[model samples]
Target chain A: MSLNFCFLGAGNLATHLSKSLKEKGFNIIQVYSKTNKSAKTLADVLNSDYTTSPAKITINADVYFVALKDAVFDEVLSKINLENKLVVHCSGSLPVSVLSAYSDKTGVFYPLQTFSKQRDVDFHKIPVFVEANSEEIQNKLIQIAEKISDSVTVLESAKRKYLHIAAVFACNFVNHFYTISAEILKTKDIPFEVLQPLILETALKVQEIEPEKAQTGPAVRFDENIISDHLNEIKDLKNYAELYNSISKSIFEHHQNLK
Target chain B: MSLNFCFLGAGNLATHLSKSLKEKGFNIIQVYSKTNKSAKTLADVLNSDYTTSPAKITINADVYFVALKDAVFDEVLSKINLENKLVVHCSGSLPVSVLSAYSDKTGVFYPLQTFSKQRDVDFHKIPVFVEANSEEIQNKLIQIAEKISDSVTVLESAKRKYLHIAAVFACNFVNHFYTISAEILKTKDIPFEVLQPLILETALKVQEIEPEKAQTGPAVRFDENIISDHLNEIKDLKNYAELYNSISKSIFEHHQNLK
Candidate 1:
């Protein structure tokens, strides 16, 4: 059966995901956004109707994706009238049941990766996370998502929450660490490009070893000399000094606990 | 003036470096290593004569690169009887004056990047850290390094020591981190390729921002909720748990201090 999709937000994820779904033989009947123009722009591209108001979504679609800010889920659901039509919110942090306010047949279609407006996502490679209200909805959602991605998974809300938290550690936190490293190199008049290979190699390592097992540094080695030298180097930057000290200490302490 | 060349060690570094220098228009007259076979192999490649003994190095290159390990510097220098032959060691941790016993014309050409036999360096981008016995050697070393790389700097041993420490944080430590992240993904049946972009962008952020300014995470944000959840998720992995707690605490503490 050809599934139909109506997306509520014509943002990065919406624009990319809708086009991908449409290309995968799904019928995208409508697009809606807070801004009328953004909705119309996406709707025109998807060959669907564009509307400024969620209340104006007159036609029924098999699946409606509400890709909104985390803070506004409740308000947005309250404004929508999906009636018993299947509606899914694309969020990692929000619970699957959060869409129950708008429609009983609701679920989640969380894509577990970072989305930048400029970077076009390869939906085929991206892991589409699906969580539906019932086994029937799950089957449909899974099939629809699988059409767009080979890496589709039926993750429960609880497990999805765990994955989201893990993503925070693996993605957001990791990013900040890189930023700090670049900052240090910049102050020394070193080009940041010098660290590119090192960075690429780091991420690639996880493919072979567990994160816990793969850990290294003065912290893991208990190399006091290098640790002290690092401490001295970042002394002027108190935050960085503390970061270096604490992470190093944690690495050593973690290893000691193992023994 | 075209500088005459001498290589004090034809070990891995000296072999690669001498080849690179020869390509950069410097004459590599002789190759020396503890093993005559290693020396002969490299010497044959360079068309330079081979010697098993540093003391037997009759032909002098303009710059003699002592690529011997840290433990062997004194032993290697004691045998190499030479006048001012512009002796240098390619070690970031060692002082340029370590060659003081052998010659007044001494400098250090420590490339501030990891070099593994499998990975060939882009010499043009590699940070070549240089220091010399005096200002004259300093200028000469800088020009020589500049011939190979634009990212050349004159750092006395003290600054180079700091740079070495920084390199640990950015490279060695960073690589271990990738191992951890890769493990985290793999345990969930997720491929490491999914995490590559995030890892790359994390490092890229540092090129434009200070590591301190670019730092992000639940730790940096002081989000107690996510931290507690993540801590619980890895509770069975106690060593990793402790590491998580400590690093998170450190990042939180850094933010608290900042505020």
Candidate 2:
């Protein structure tokens, strides 16, 4: 029989991950959340029992998956007892040590992709990074990860933290630029759809070419005329102008070092 | 007969645009660049004559496509005389007046996509923005643009400049973030490939959802603890930390405004 799993937290990441696991034939036996609505919503989708109270969390499951916010790990985990069952937290930044105090068999199962509750992602393509306190638990976690992902690696907490930071730069910060682009286009009465092709192409280019060699625009060329013009246009918007100047200077310096 | 074209720059954009037009059955009659290697290289591919001297540019082509650098437009355009022939420039930031002095009929034919000569792009899907001095030239430019692209819009110079700025943020600066991500990953002995899925998903997410609504990360939540930890970790890198703080503050303020 497939291993029984219990989920702690039912946010975007938990919802997507639990549904994906269920689709792969694993049994998600229960879900626990601080909020009843979120718990019940995701639990209903998985056909699993759910409780808003941490003390009511099921203890018989073979594995426990904690997907809470980093800030609440202690308060949430302290209330539940898993009794040495394999426990995994799906976080990009938090270390496995956060779960070690609560269970002897603890590990991390982090999928390196952004998740939205409304969107469905192919887990087979997402890289899942795993880490555990013992080899047995590590292998057990890897087996589960390999079921869902084509690429699974045993990453330590040290390297995982940097990976998380790099993700912030690549995904979170990059999305902010998209937001800025949308705001700029909005001022001109242009639809954001016009930028979709360029944005997609830009990301696609880096897949084949090194990002350093793939770089373009006034900053790379250090074209002061166009750069100054762009700055002047957005100078009224203090934060944007500052970001434009800072990134431009960074790009110029980076290229200069390349030469 | 198809239109005869003379390309006045042999850079990435010129090579791609000229080759795309040739593939569509247009006749590329000549190629010109300040450097003979660039001129001859693209000319050899197109089976066209080439010249390094601006004075030697062919004046008899039906359309003169000038794709030179923005700063050198005056110095280059002043050297070629197109008489009453249609002159079109492929620049995002330049005004239509830049080509007006060289021909009685001048227009702008800017493709809103990034280009690299090593990669082939499907121009049929790329949006082509056109502007001209008159309705006759505008319609003529739009017809040519439509032949290559499914989406063609006649936008004024005033609005095109803003579009260009948005592209810089979306394509140029966004690529810079990719570079930074690679650098951060390198320090930890991690390949940049690990971030590719996240990077691509971030771009793809904006296609179906508004960027403001799609935004995620510690910044949007204003998670002080995680933000401070990340800042401390990258404090040694002056520029990266500055950018981290700046963009985080911007994201925080932006989401706060929505509330």
Candidate 3:
């Protein structure tokens, strides 16, 4: 029989995961949030029971997923009794061990993608990283993940932590660079759309070429004139200027060493 | 009468531009490169005259496009007399003044996109930033630019320089981050392909939403624990670890100030 799932949060990840799972014919038995409105909103879509209080969570559900923020994971987990049932947390950085005391079947169900409430992600393309304490649990987790995603991997906590960090660099930090670039254009009255094509192509290139081989720009070329000119342009924006100098220096040094 | 074009370089930009112009029915009269073989390769494709000598550039062509690197622009322009014909350089940072002494009618025909020999970019979607010394020259340049691309803008050299700098940040520097992330993943035997969906989606999100609003990850939320943990993961790679801390701190501070 298919295991019934209970979501312990109704934030972006929880909503996206629950909706995708529901579409795949998984039974989402309950949806829990700190606020009733948020829980009810997703529960209606999942056709599941809703609750704001942990005490109201359905113990009968075979699996429970805590998808809350990292800071609240401990406090939230402390309130729920897993009764040796399968429990997992949908966090990228958090270790699977966080749920070990509550259930022997504790594991991780991290979907490695930037989730936005407004955007509907195609889970088929998203890589779901599953981790568990035992082989049986790991196999079961991978099976469930495969239902929603074409790419699923069993990652250990140590490697998963590094993967999450690597993601922060690739996704989060890269987006911040976009934010900085947009700010630069705004000062000159140039629309952000001008940078959109370049941004898209840059990412697309990496798919075919290795990032080290694909690297370009003033930094890689060690073009001091262009770098100096760029520094002059951002002199007033001290922090951003420092960032440009630092990153450029690092890239230059990296390539210099490679040569 | 349709403008007859002469290309001064047979590199990525020259090849792409000439091909697109040729397809759009522009007469490519000549193709010049630093070497005869390189010149012949593109010239045969465009069905234009090929030459390695700048002195051999066809004077009959309406406009001459100096598409070489900025380092060679001065040297190449010095070698040839444009014969008071319309001349332009396809450089982002170089000002229109670089061509002013070369010809009475000088302008800039910078296509604002990274050009790679391996990639075929759609000029129709690429924005061509046009600038010239006079209204007549500007109008002619705009007409030629419009033949291939739907998006064309008249930007002064001053604004164009900043735009180029911004491109370096958005495209070049952003690609470097991908390099760094890929490096981190390689240490753990994780394939860079795993991060492809996240990278593409991160860029996709900014299309509809402002980047400042679209920013995600532990840094934006200021999760110091994860930040510290990431720093730990990169402890051996000093430069990358420093970059991680700096960018994360910047994003954290940027969001903190906004709040």
Candidate 4:
């Protein structure tokens, strides 16, 4: 049977998955977003119908995915029509059970990847993390997820929460670290391009080895000479200097703790 | 003129650069390290004379790259012959004038990257940041460095110091963030592979946009809901929890300073 799918949000993640699933021969029934333009734009790509309102959305599709921001998930779901359709949310941060009152077979179909409107994502490589309330829905979610990605991970809500937190640490926190580096470089009139190779290398290394094992730094070696020199170097960047010192101190303390 | 490159210390950086330079047709005249194996391994690859004793490294070279540890730069320079053999050190933290007493042709040939034996570097994009006592040595260092790398940045000592400090923030500090993510993933028994795509995308984004404009997370928006949830989620790793909170606070404060 050609399963009919309806998306309740047409954000970056929703747009991407919609396009992918459509290409895989799933019938994308309709798309919903805050604005009609966005919904129509994404629905046009999937060759599906579009709706601007949660209340206007019909219960014709077998699947409905809520792809709103995490903070508004409850408020957004409250307005949705989740009848016999298997309702789900594509959020990594929230659990699937948040849709329990709306539908008997609500679940999660979270794709663990950073989505941006600018970048083109390869859905085949992205690990699809899935979960559901019932066995039938779980199997259906897994089957649908496997159509888009080879790497399908059926995780419990608890584990998915951990993964989301880990993503906050890895992706979001790491971006802040880069912002710090770029800020310093801008002040020095040093072109930020120089940091690119090192950034790529650091990320690649972590993929292959444990971060603790891959660690290489002045702080790790307890190279006080370099740390002191570095401290003096960042003297003009008052806040940045404090950051440098605190991080080195923390890393040094972590190293000591391990020892 | 066949410039005989003599490594004053066959450390990780020294060994990697020596191999790259050797492959590029620059002669590594001698290899010297505190440990015998360190010198021997690099010397074998470089096809050069090797010695553990710095005093025995008597061969004349165009550039004597003192790739010693930061703490032992002075001690190592004292032990080695540095009358006027284009004495330079591969240290980002050390001042160019550290070798001023020993030679007029003093400079730095600091490769701005973290090198490990496991990772084979493609020198094409690696930026070689250099500083020298004289214009002639600076020019010569530039020429020599350009042979291997497409990116050669001729920076004064002040700018070089700034770049070095920025690198610590970029490479070293960014890596600590990676470790934190890995720890979070491990505690949850989630394979780090789940976060790989996210990690790659996060790093790649900065290269295309100004880091300030590219930054996204709960801290920037001051989203207390997610921040509070993350605080509770990270209750087990207290140190890391504090780290996340501390940096987020700093980042938020810094962004305010910008406005």
Query: Number of clashes in every candidate structure?
Result: 15, 0, 0, 0
Clashing pairs in 2: none
lDDT of 3 at A25: 88
Models ranked on DockQ: 2, 3, 4, 1
Model 1 chain B poorest ten-residue lDDT run: B112-121
Per-residue lDDT of model 1, residues A1-259, tens digit only = 7777788888777888999988888889988788988888888889998888766764577777888665556655676567878888887666787777778898889876655544466777677889888999999888888888887778887767656655666666566555566567667675656666555554545544445564544566576655676687778964678767756665666568678
Ranking by lDDT: 2, 3, 4, 1
Please state the error at residue A242 of candidate 4 in Å. 3.6
Q: Which candidate should be chosen as best, given lDDT against the real structure?
A: 2
> After best superposition, candidate 1 residue A159: deviation in angstroms?
5.3
Displacement of residue B170 (Cα, Å) in model 2 is 0.8
Clashes of 2: 0
Error of 1 at A103 (Å): 4.5
Query: What is the docking quality class of candidate 3?
Result: medium
lDDT of 2 by residue, B70-177 (tens): 888777778877788999998787889977677889999999998876678898889999999999999988888888899999999888988988999899999999
Per-model lDDT: 0.70, 0.89, 0.87, 0.81
lDDT for each residue of candidate 3 in A88-155, tens digit (9 for 90 to 100): 88888888897877888888999999988889899999999999989998888998999999999999
Residues B3-35, candidate 4, lDDT per residue (tens digit)?
888888876788789888888888888888889
Lowest lDDT sum, 10 consecutive residues, model 4 chain B, at B75-84
**Model 2 - which docking category?**
high
| 2 or 4, greater by DockQ | 2
Task: Give the C-alpha miss distance for residue B254 in model 1, angstroms.
Answer: 7.9
TM-score, candidate 4, chain B alone: 0.94
